[model samples]
Target: MILWGRPSSVNVQKVLWALSESAVPFDHHIVGGKYGGTDTATFKVMTPVPRVPVLQDGDLTLWESHAILRHLAGGVPPLADQWMEYTTSTLQPAFLQMFYELVRTAPADRTKDAEALKATFLAAVAPLEWQLRKTQWLGGDSFGMADIAAGAMMVRACDLCDPLSPQVARWYEQLQTRPAYRAVVMTSYEELRA
Candidate 1:
C-alpha cells in the first residue's frame, strides 16, 4: 500500500495515524500543500479531485481521508463511523473555518471574525466534549477511527482556540501520550502558517 499527501493536512494525519495503529506498512509520498505534485497526470488519474492523501493498495485506489480509514479498519465500526461522519460534516468544517482564518491566512489578509470562528467551533464540538465524558474513546470501548477522525481536529484546535471544553483538553493530553499521534498529528505545522 502507498499513501500520498502532505503530513500537515488533518485528513492526511488521520490516515497516517490509522496506519500506525494498525501496524500496516506502506510507502508515503508528500504530494500537496507546499510540496506541489498534485497536478501531475499520474496523480490526476489516481483521484477524481486533485487533493492530498490518496491511497493505492494493490489494484485498489482510494480517495477521501475517511474512506481510506474505513478500508484500513477492514470494516467500519457502527458508532465509530457515525462519529467519523460527524467529524466530516460538522466538526471538520468548523475546524477548517478557524484553522484557515488563524493559521493558513496571513494576518493582514485575515478578515473573518476570530471570535466568531472560535465560538462556532466550540459549539460544533459540544457533543464530542459530552461524548468523551461517557466513553474513554469515541468508538465505544476502544480508540478507533472515530477518535482518529475527531481527535485530529481536536489536536489542531488546541493551539488555536481558547478552549473547546475541559473534557476536550483532557482528551488532547491523553492523545499526546500516543506515539502515533505525536509523530503524525503533533508535528509542527509551521510550514502551514501564513
Candidate 2:
C-alpha cells in the first residue's frame, strides 16, 4: 500500500495518523502542494482530483482525506461509516475554513480582520466542544476516524484558528497522549520542526 502527499499538510496528516492508529504498514511517496511534484502525469492519473494524500493499495486507488480514511478503516474496530460522516459532515468544512483563513490571506488582512476570523473559528468550535464534552472520542470513547479528522485540525489549530477554545485545547491535549498519535506526529512533523 502507498500514500502520496506532503507530510506537512493537515489533510495528509489525517491519513498518516489513521495509518499509525491502525498499525498499518505502508510506504509513503512524498508529493503534492508545497512539496510539489503533482505535475507528473502518473501522479495525476492516480488521483482524479489530483490532490494530496491519495492512497494506492494493490489495485485500488482513493482520494479525499475522509474517503481515504473510510476506505482504510474498513472492518477496523470502532471506526465505521458514521465516523466518516462525522469527519466529512462535522469537521472538514470548519477545518477548511480555518485553513483558508490562515493560508489564503495576507498577514495585514489577517491582522485587520483578526476579530472576525476568530469569531468564525469560535462559532465553528461550539458544536465540536459540545460533542467532545459528551464523549472522550468523537465516536464516543473509542479513537476512530472521527477523532482522526478532528485531531488533524486540533494539531494545526494553533496556526489555523485563533483564540483556541479551552475545550478544544483540552481535547487536543488528550489526543496527544495517545501513543499512536504521538508516533505519527513525532515521525512526520517533529523532525521537520527541528
Candidate 3:
C-alpha cells in the first residue's frame, strides 16, 4: 500500500492514525501542500480531484480521508461513521477556518478571522463534549475510527482555542494514551505551524 500526503495534513493524519492503530504496513510518500508532488501527471491519473491522503492498495486507489479510514477498518461502525460525518461536515469548517487564521496567517492579520470563527468552533465542539460525557469514545467505550477522524482535530483545537470542556479534555487525555494516537496524530507538525 502507498499513502500519498504530507503528515501534517489533518486528513492525512487521520489515515495515518488509523493505519497505525490497525497495524497496517504501508509506504508513505509526502505530497500536497509544502511537499508539492500532488500536481504531477501520475498523481493526477490516480486522483482527478487532486486531494491529499490518496490511498493506493494494489489495484484499488481510494481518495477522501474518511473513506480510506473506513476501508482500513474493514467495516464501518454506524455510530462511528455518524460521528465522523459530524466531524467533517459540522466541526471541520469552523475548525479549519480558525486553524488557517491562527496557524497559517500572520498574527497581525489573524484576530478578526479567528474571532469570527471562535463561536462557531465552540458550538461545533459542544456536541462532542456532550457526547463524551456519555461514552469514553465517540463510538462507545472502545476507541474506533470515529476517534481517528475527530481526534485528529483535537490537537489543533487545543492549540488554537481556549480551554476545552472537561469532558472533551478528559476524552482527549484518554486518546493520548493510545500508542498509535501518540505516534501518528500527536507528532509535532512544525512545518504546519506558522
| Local accuracy of candidate 2 as per-residue lDDT tens digits, 6-69 | 8777788889999888788999999876577777988878876767988998999998888788
Query: Which parts of model 2 are misplaced by more than 4 Å?
Result: 75-90, 108-112, 160-167, 183-194
lDDT of candidate 3 over 41-146, digit per residue (tens): 9999999887899999999999999999989888877888899899889888889888888788777766665666888899999999888989989998888999
Off by over 4 Å in 1: none
Off by over 4 Å in 3: none
lDDT for predicted candidate 1 compared with the true structure: 0.88
What TM-score does each of the candidates earn? 0.96, 0.80, 0.94
Q: For model 1, give the 10-residue run with minimal summed lDDT.
A: 162-171
Give residue 80's lDDT in candidate 1 (0 to 100).
Answer: 88
lDDT of each: 0.88, 0.71, 0.87
Clashing pairs in 2: none
| RMSD (Å) per prediction | 1.1, 3.8, 1.4
In TM-score terms, which candidate is top?
Answer: 1
